[model samples]
Each structure stands twice: as structure tokens, then as C-alpha cells.
Target chain A: MASDRTASQPESSRGYAPASGPESERGAGPRAGSVQCTSRAAPAIGAPGHQAGAGPALHDLDQATIVARAQNGDVSAFEWLLSAHEGGVFRLALRMLGDRAEAEDIVQETFIAARRSLPDLAAPQSFIPWLYRVATNKCFNLLRSRRRHPAHPDAFDDGSVPAGSHDAFAWGEADPRHQGDTCGGLCQDPALRYEAEAQMRALTGLLQAVPAGPRACWLLRDVHEFSYTEIATIVHLPESTVRGRIARARRILAEGMQSWR
Target chain B: MAMNGGKPRLGCGRLIDDVWASIDQPATIHERSCRDCQSARAALDHLEAVTRSMRERDRGDAAQRPSSRVREAIMAVARAEVRRSRRVPLATTPLGTIDISEQALNDLIRFAASTLPGVRARRCTVLRSPTPQSSPGGPSSAGVVDGGDVRITLTVALSSQVRIPATMTLLRERVGTIVQAQTAITMQQIDIGVEDLYDA
Candidate 1:
């Protein structure tokens, strides 16, 4: 019944490409003039001037120079790269897999693989997207394997958190001191905080119902704030397909979240 | 336009997809004046808000950082792999050969150079003496000869307060002694280049 209804929906609503879409729809790079929906408030991964605690000399070096040094077997440079990127990689893994230990393992494996192949990377600018691709692929493989053998009953088929997991719902409840920066003074009120946390928990529960592929696209777009071109490159999908998956995921989540309105 | 659920469509006839797209993109002429698109956008804006909130929460989580143990393990693996791929021949016997990693030699030279009062080693390249029978026109490779003489070139950054000639003499002596002591190979020559300068 669901498939039938989906098939009946208009192609535009399903996010299929129009007969003559904009040039940016042709899967060009970030410079192709596509409208990036999210602002990157955090320091860009691998970009210079963001190395807070690195040595003064290393801090002054750009990412390309650092990558070149690492390629030449500079262990200190590699360590600097790891320190800069490990957190972002871990968060990506955690969101995709919903298991902390497994996510940590993915981070370790990704960097080791990167170290082994660093010499072969032809372009230094592609390092961030390439690293993300490695981590995302590992998550995809783990999710695929989980489907074959259901080890954790609480984790969904797509590896998202179960509705009952308190960790999934807690938000800032466990440590009020760590309330996220976005909530500001509104979250200072206990009543407002509780209400927001409840809403977040409900929304997260709804997210688990989304299949893995679309969920990944949605998370990369909305949460990580990757441009559509970057998402397509990381996930190894065409730009149109990425748009379609994100749209479908959003429709499902919005439908499920109607009650919150 | 078609509506999937039984929810009211306000007063406009545009599809809900158009409304959602308009939330993230510039609105079309029709969407700008349409009340239905505005209402649907307001409703859909809630999802965007929650998603942003979740992103912030994820960022603020202390647990998101990889553990120190994990970092150490990654570094250990990387060092091992890099060393394994690059071993320089130190000595050879009729029975077998003894080799040291190029990285180990570089680390030794860098450490020795760093002991100087105002020098920081940036890079170290070791050139091993070619075997006696090797072709002269062919490429000269490191780690071919057993107990061969090795040439060392060390790049360093110096403090503005240091004298260049005295620092270079001290650096060459220190690196030569350390390399000879550690590897038992006579240094053919040691060349030091001051590549950068820093404030004292």
C-alpha cells in the first residue's frame, strides 16, 4: 500500500529532476551555484586557522602542506590531521550507527586506512570528502551486516536508536550544564527544557523509521551541512538521487511529526 | 495540487513539495504571494528547527570526542605501518642482513639536531652509499650496501638570536656523533640548511 501510494505521487513531489532543471542539478562541484541550505558555523574540517592546540609552526601550515608532509611519512603531521578530524568522523559514525563503541571503532579504522593510502591521494583538497567517504562506507557496511544478523535487538534494522533508549531521549537532561549552544536562555527554564527534550526524543524516534540510505542523505544535508554536491560525492550517488532520497526522508519525518505542530 | 493526508491546505493549490522546497530555497513568484505556501512553510520550519537543535546537541556532547586510547592506537598503527614500508640497510652478513627504518634514522637525526639551543629540525634525508658494482647511470638507492657510508641533509628552523656559523658547526658535530653512535656507520658528510627563522 505504501509503495503504491508513493508511486502515485507526482514526480516533482518525489524530487525527481524536471525536464530541464538548473545547471547545478547536473552534479557539479560546490562551485556550481547550488543553494546550500545550512550555514557552516563550525570551523571547516581540514581548513587552516582552526588548529587550536597544534604547534605554532604546524598551526601556520595549510591543509595541503600538512597532507603533503603526512604523505612523505611525517608522523607528527599525521597526528595533527587525526586530532583535527577525529571528532567529526566519530560524530558522523555515531549518527549513522547509533552505537557509540561501533562508531569509535569506525573512526579508528578509517584513519588507519587513510594513513595507509595517504601517499596515493592525488589531490590534497579532496582529503576531507575522501575521509568522510571512507567513514560513511564503513557505516554502510556495518548497517548491511546488521541486516544479515540481528545482534542488537534495540537497534533498528537501519541501526538507529530504539524508542526506549534513555540515552536517545535524554538530550541535555543528564547534564543540564551541557545544554547545547542553540537553545540559549530558552532552555534555562526547566519547563521549556523538558518540553524541548521531549520533542527531540519524539523526533528522533520518528527518524528511526527512515531507511538507512535516505537517512544518511538527510543527516549529511541537514545536520552536517554538507552541500548536495559533497553529499553525492561522499555517498557515491548521483546528485538527483541524493535530492530524491533527502526529499523522501523529509516527507516521512514531517508526516510523522505532524502532532508536534 | 494533490494532498496526501486529510490536513487542510489553507487556500492555495500548490503541492506540499513546492512548499518544502521553498523553505530551503528562494520562493517562486507564485509561492511568494500564496498563503498556503506560507502556512506550509511555517509548519515545515519546525522540522528544520529540531534538526538544527539536534546538531547542536551532538556537537556539545563531551562523549563525541574519541578517547585518548583510540588516538594512541591509531598513531601506533600508523607509525608501525610507515616504518615497515621504509627500512634502510644498516649492515649485511653472509647469513642475512640488518636493516633500520629510514624513519628511525630521521627521528635520530632530528632528535640530535633539536638538542642544540636554538634549532628545530624540520626534515632529515639520509643518502646511503651505492654498492661497489652498481651502475653509475642508474638511480642511486638508499640501503643497498652493508656498513656503507651515509650522507645526511638536515633542514632546520633557527631562532633569531642564534649565530648561523656556530649553530651549523655544533649541529653537524652533534648529528654526526649521534648517527655514528646509534648506527655504527661513518657519516660521509653532514649538511645543515637553516630553512626558517623564529623569534627567540
Candidate 2:
């Protein structure tokens, strides 16, 4: 959305709301992240701090008081805390478990665990990593179980051959010159598009093949951009162990990705 | 290489796993110039591309979000957790003062902000600016303003189509008018923020 001081157009200037939704629907998050502002201006209720601009930085204001209230049996405060963290917890579970149904179950389990342990939580600053740590464990448990039950559904893969076994560019006898370019996703040429998609399928297989420990480290580092220390906290490992695991995961992934070249 | 399940593929040699895994490691001259390392590097690049591509697709899939039932269950638990009575005093009068809960006031603000053309007011923080004599750190309540000007700070997601300036003006006016009219609380500063643009 355009920022402050954008030219004020008359209502008439707003043409019939565009024919359809915005072309890109990326990063549309869950409603739980919505802030319920309670200003300290009133003696009866005060959530504290009315930030002029809105962003993650603004939302980062401590919820120590709210968390304290929740721990002391304030349902309202608990609700706000849950809402703020639920979507993120769910997303983490989805990515780690790779199954929507399983992720939902883990989300439920994570909240239950969080609620039980919240009173013991040291402070609001650690709330996010603490919550993530809970969800990550739930996802880890599910992954281990899925490994045992070979028949379990793997949303991670769908019968595509790994690119390491064949030429990724050779999709259904496709073009030889179609070098996979990461110039934003889909290619204009149908053959190149097919090749690109096949390569993605192969990579997905390799990702699923990664053991849970290294996979979490690699994903938290690469995709979620968690710091090594933060990751260690969430995974309950030494900082050095986290680094070594991430490096090892990368090495394994590099070998598996070789065919994409 | 043909598609064969049992056969091991001829893949890149050892540099990627042993040397490149720990990215902090500087590559030797041979490792940098070797045919296998170059191919390994490209493969690593492709690995990143694949993850990025997956995230993009996953982000677009809004349907994958948790169900409404989950939200309802959470709200149910939260509401059930509030055992104590809740009330907000609007004003004092000769007969009696009308009390409105904090949630009710916030609801009014949300309602006012939503009525504006193509705007969803999210995270509305209504703070009463401290009086000139009072310390800045003074605690302020939701409805018990104690005769100080009210400052409304909120984040809103704007529709992609509307003109931001006009909408912002409408938002400030609507919020101020509603808060004043509903509870006799006059607004001093209305801080409106545009957080994100949505398809509406």
C-alpha cells in the first residue's frame, strides 16, 4: 500500500474496485498476528505504547505484562498471546512436517504444551523462540513417527524421480538447451517451464530425504533465517553443534543437488 | 544419466561436502578451479532456487492456513479463562456513570475504521496522551481518560485500489468522530499507519 501523503483523490477517482484481487497474493498472513492495542491513557485498561508506524519492529514491544496476566489466570491476556503466536507456530509445523493435516495437529499440541509451560517462561523476550521450540519438537516427533510408518502420506514428495538419477532438462523428452535459470520462477517457453518444474520436484525429494535434525537446522538457517544461537536454543543443542549440523546438512544437500547442474 | 533406481549416479566429487559445507572455509586453488566444484556450486545455487520457489508457492496458497474452527476454539478458551467481571467507566454523572468494557470501545474503533473505503483497521491502540503537568510515564486506562486528550495509534491494511491520502483522512475523521460520539471522549491525535496493501 502507498505510504503517507499520497495524493488525496476524490471518491469518484476510485474506479469501480479493480476487476479482481491483486495479482500477487503472497505473504497474506493469519489474523492471529493482529495487535489488540490497549493504551495506558486510561486507568482501567492499558496495553501500553501506541507506535506511530506499524511493522514488525513496532509489534516487537514487550508483552511482559500481558504474559504475566495470562500466567496469573487472565484469559484475555492468554488470548492475545495465542493469537500473536499461532500463525507462526502453524507455519513452522507445516514446513517441518510437510503435511497440512499433521501440521494442524502439531499446532494444537504446541499450544497445549505452551499453555502448560508458559508460567515457567522466563520473560516475554524469549516467548517466540520458546514457542518455536515447542512447535519444532512436535514436528520432530511427527517426522520420526512418519519414518516408522512407511505408508504414511508424505506431502514432501509425489513420485517424481530425483534429478540426480537423470537429466533434469529432459522432461518428457524436452529441450537440451534449456538451462534452468532462476529468473523469477516460470519460464515463457513450455519446455523450459517443464524442466524447471521437474527440477523442483527432484529438489523436494532431496529435502524430504534429509534427516529431521539437519533438515531443521538447514531450513531454520536458510529459509527462516534464524540465527545459529537462536536455532540452538529452539533445538536445545549447543551453538557449535548447530553450526556443525547446518554445515553437514548443506554438504549432503550439495551432493544431492548435483544433478540440477 | 538414465532414470534407474538401483544404480548410483556419477555425481560431483568430495569438495562440496567436505570443504564447501562449512561455508566459512576458504577454498583451495584446486577446489576453486576443479570441474566438480564448479558443478557443485551450481547445484548449490539450484538448491537455494528450489527452496525459494517452494516458499513463493506456499505463500500464495492462502487456503493452506489453519481453519476457522481453530480460531473459534482459541477464542472460546480465552473467553472461558476470564473468570473476573469486566467493566469500563465512560463518565461520571449526578445520577450514575455509564460503563463500557475496554473490548466494546476497541470494537467501536474497529467498526469505525472498517467503514472507511477499502480499509481494515488492525491493531488499534488508543492511548490518552498525558496532561502537560503529568509525567510521560503515567498509566492511562482505556475509557477512564481523566480529562486528557486521547491519542489513537493504529495499523491498517489498505486496499490496493484506493488513494492512500484520501482514505487516511477519512479514517482519522471517522475514528475521531466515532470515539467522541460514542463515549464523549474527544480525540487529540490520530496516528494512522499503512502497514500493508492487500487485494481486498
Q: Can you give the TM-score per candidate against the true fold?
A: 0.60, 0.50
Expressed as tens digits, the lDDT of each residue in B91-148 for candidate 2 is: 7799997776544555567667767766655545556544455556775343254433
Task: Give fnat for candidate 2.
Answer: 0.14
Model 1 Cα lDDT, one tens digit per residue, A1-261: 011011211100111221222111111221111111111011112222333222345554445445645765778778878877787788778777777899899999999999888878875546777888898999888888887786643332322422332211211111223322224224787876776677677777676677778778777777666667878998998876676667656656655655565
Fnat computed for model 1 = 0.19
**Which stretches of candidate 1 lie above 4 Å from their native place?**
A1-55, A150-186, B1-21, B24-29, B32-36, B85-100, B104-200
Stretches of candidate 2 off by over 4 Å are: A1-88, A144-180, A183-198, B1-28, B83-200
Q: Considering every candidate listed, which one attains the maximal TM-score? A: 1
lDDT of 1: 0.61
lDDT score for residue B188 of model 1: 70
Docking quality class, candidate 1:
incorrect
Q: For candidate 1, write residues B75-192 as lDDT tens digits.
A: 9998777666456677779989788877777767776777777765655666555567667787654434334656766556566577766566676777777778988866676665
CA lDDT of each prediction against the hidden true structure = 0.61, 0.54
The TM-score obtained for chain B of candidate 2 when compared with the true chain B: 0.52
The DockQ values of the predictions, listed in order, are 0.11, 0.11
